[model samples]
Target: MYRILIVDDEPMIRKGLQKLVEQSELPIESLRTAENGVVALQRIGEERPDFLFTDIRMPKMDGLELCARVAEMDADIQVVVISGFGDFEYAQKCVSYGVKEYLLKPVNIKGFQNVLEKLIRTKTKVSSETFVAVTKLEQWASRMEHAVWMLQEAELKGLISEILEELQAYKLKLNRVIDILQEIHTLLHQRLNVRDVYLMQGELELTGAADEQEAWCRFTAAVHGHLEELRAKRKGKLKDPVEEAKQYIETHLAEEVSLEEVADFIGLNPSYFSQLFKQSTQETFVQYRTRRRMEKAKKLLEQPQWRITDISGEVGYADHPHFTKTFKKYEGCLPSEYRQQMGIRT
Candidate 1:
């Protein structure tokens, strides 16, 4: 409900205005009055009314001056001028001060009601429009986030046209969309998890669209196309021993696995496997193992049912102390601290 303040030098005028406003059907919760502009300013500072009705010719501070002061204090408050004099120049000055309405001396009850109703209706309409605009912006942002997630997964085979449509529907600038798509591509190239890569790929496809849905479909198509290309290339390259090593690491993450064991599985010497793994992955075998184990541990930590001790054992760390030390070294925090920081229940 809106709060109202009536400021006038005459006691009778203030009383009449207060009674009339209170009798109105407007959802006004509070009605306050002051005899002069100085007292009105004081009441305003105390209560901060949403609407102000003030006489124009008050001593010390006239209605115009009071309105100006109120604007400086809180521009959101609506001010209406009430004057016994019908001076056109005075009314013009009130308008200049951002007063919504001006009333001549001896207020017309029906006219005043009409003016108030118009003001309330206009305010409501503007607020509703703003809310709708904000909701659409939020939804567009959410769609963009989802698209980015798909792009990161490198799955952009069937979404090209859909992405184009989304861009158009959202009225997104083509250049900005392209920049976001490029960023997602770079992130995918960094070897993020499959989920993240998929998201990035989806976003990239959407960037091509004129609307959100179209962007999504385009992203899916792009991912499929990319996978096809990768498959064709894979046929030409020698069998990836590094890929075999990675698969072995994933399957035996809970076992005391080592490069020697992986080398034996692939029928390669331990020293050769180590060199080949580094050359293929640009990371040492031990670094790769630790990264893989840490990633698994992070996933397990998301489960509230798993204790830190059990998580450590599941990630192939036999000693709890050693697990804590290594976790801290790789993750820059103890396992428990990591879980807390991530808001994981475990």
Candidate 2:
């Protein structure tokens, strides 16, 4: 399936290309339209298209500049330059930036199909050689986001390795790899309250990487170290009251515990405890309690020996109907359904 992006300042041209492609017999998986190179670049970052057909003159960033950036970003993308008679010279210069073909103004359906067919042949050849689906690329982004959010160290390491392999497969430039790593760093930093905890210059520099192997090694090590530090910080002091409160919650998850009970146990006033819990755990007292209870319920449900009724009571629910309802609300499945999905036979 072909993924194409059309970039032109004129809304009519963009829509025209989109409509033409849709009506054609070409095996187009998706077609995206952009007003200018700026939006085009953003879309490329999310998922690089197989073919990019762009006009020469644009408002924010011109096609020439965009082509230059794309050359550095992904060399595999097939670029076709769109130009009028007056801009032929400028479009000619775009050839050096890896543009495959040039389309003159007043685009004809016949010429469009010819150029598109040629590109499709080339795209198919390349795909036969080494094809990576658009969905797989998008999945990498989603997996990376979740790994970073949960601070799953092993999962993060594996994802970083997979990403490096993909970049290597595409043969991206050193700067492009650096930019990708920086984007991940920005995501991680935004999720945490910590400032500049990512790999900065004078700490662990990727710019000085000797080769692709060194770059991947240095990048992963630096990020892993930073994550370790952040994890340690979140662990806090051993005797911290917040830590004690968390332990208390874990220990008494089978019992109906309240904010007042935990607060008194921790030797703090209920109001102060509520505020501290929210600030530290990023959730209200009731929310944290319910989330923990549901987590425990799910864990117990994994064991085939544990009945749904027993698991519910073990996670603090007294009534079977209420447990089923709560479990369905939290997990989008009833307790039995969840266990069945987990491949647990009663």
Candidate 3:
């Protein structure tokens, strides 16, 4: 999906280009029009579109100047020049500003569509190769949400640090990093709102930053500060967080539950929850959860009516072979072999 803005002084040209774009059957999330470079720059600053289509001749600021300004701020935006003049100097200026495609007015439908096709293909490839997928961001944000709720400052920092090390290693792009941070911020806000626990919502903006390092510094500072507030608000408030952790773990055994989420549910720091749970159960949290899952898997395997694959999923192991290996580790044989030894016939 893409957001494209058209900049042309002539209303007819803008409409024609917009129509052609609509007819391209491309994935266009938004199509906006600005009469000249100044308004286009204003819109670009507000939200960086994936592509900008502008005519060379315009009032106030020309397309050449707009391209230069965009390059100065965010060079990732692809600029396609639509000009009435074809002077060699204009071509040179556009090339200098990293303008990949330049179209002469009385725009040929085929040529224009070709440019659109090429840009979309290039963008799709760049997005796949360069940016982390939104789904991955969502998963990370899920963990961050849990960490924030649990007041696990260490876990929060660890998660953010891992992401920053990978994505911000080079100048990949700020928009992608901004998207991830904004997603995290939105999820945290929504989750906290659901609990009727509201805190100071700090500004999380990275689009205006020069690079992702600035984003990392600002995001970490803000989120860590929010964590301090959470710690203060819920300090020593839970009644027997260890027991709550146990109950949450027991109920979510069929799902891939984590210690962080369990601790988050009961509002205890993960390390503190680990020690408390071990003391209460005489087994580590991981040990207890695994033992319980194995116990349940064994009971399910005894029923010949349930398939081994289904039993594996019932015990939270999605991979049947891994479940078989684990079952061998626990029961000393394959599930089918165990059933046969027990004289259980299907």
Candidate 4:
């Protein structure tokens, strides 16, 4: 259903157009009218009608000016010009503005109907394109879900060669297939698709029994039902290592906490853990720890009992000036100002 706006200085002309449109079988969802170009502009801004019909001659502003304004704002809207004179210059101007249709004094119902039909057809084509794009996106998401489920459920090492062949036959990207396989291999602690593994006696040809198939089905069902839960658990575990690293920082706030030491405690390479921690929380591990320390500093500053130096050391700063700098960077104010704002003086 398309929305339409009619603009004309004459009330009779506007009413006539509205009646003719309302009588038509076209699926016009809404129709609005304005007495002049100024009012039309206001209506257009408010409603953003799909189609516009305006008379060439009007007080304050003419049809051409209104069309130009609408085009400047949103070129997607379709416009039709109506005029009392059969002026070629006016028709040329309308053409320049990309006006869809132009009609003289006595409007021809047939010509108007034809233009309306064309506009509706164009709108329908655009809608179809949007639907196709959405459909493709949904199909891609479903395929990814299926692939993840399959990799997590079965011990895919025995079926690697067959799976590779199937993926190739399905025209799946080689890189994507390899990445999925690598993730499964890492999590399951097995060298997938290795020549030695496949060549081992009875490894390649080990077929699952009916009981095994049933178990596989149950496992697949559980995975599908709890994939979101499993993902959350994995994310939580990823955070635990970072949390443990943070504990050491809390215990020795006055001293520096090296990234290497934190990574070693969490059984991860320093560079990789730094990258992973950033990816998970959208903050560098160092920055996050600094923020945590600053928050603690702020809370400690609220207490009248703690001295600035003591508070600074308690939150992991080796020097009072350094703590003030870090606090200003994170809190947008000096530590002393922050303490004052919190009604604490020491």
Question: Among these predicted structures, which one has the highest lDDT?
Answer: 3
How far out, in Å, is residue 186 in model 2? 24
Local accuracy of candidate 3 as per-residue lDDT tens digits, 202-235: 4555566566667676677656646654774567
Candidate 4 CA-lDDT value: 0.63
lDDT, ranked from best to worst? 3, 2, 1, 4
Candidate 2 to truth, TM: 0.44
How much is 161 displaced in model 4, in angstroms?
Answer: 37
The 10-residue segment of model 3 with minimum total lDDT is: 197-206
Give lDDT: candidate 1, residue 192.
Answer: 30
| Candidate 3: segments with Cα more than 4 A from true spot | 133-139, 188-214, 235-346
TM-score of each: 0.37, 0.44, 0.60, 0.39
Model 3 residue pairs with clashes:
none
lDDT of 2 by residue, 55-77 (tens): 99999999999999888754468
lDDT of 1 at 255: 89
lDDT of 1 by residue, 1-346 (tens): 7788899999988888887787787898789988878999888656566678888887888888888787665234678788766554775687756787877778878877876886677667644542324344344434443443443333232243444555456443333344344444444433433444232212233332443344344434344434422433435534566797899998998889878899878655465466557767999988888899999888888787899999999989899999999989998999998889878755
lDDT of 3: 0.78
Off by over 4 Å in 2: 131-346
Residue 297's C-alpha lDDT in candidate 1? 88
Q: Which model is ahead, 3 or 4, in terms of lDDT?
A: 3
lDDT (Cα atoms) of all candidates against the true structure: 0.66, 0.75, 0.78, 0.63
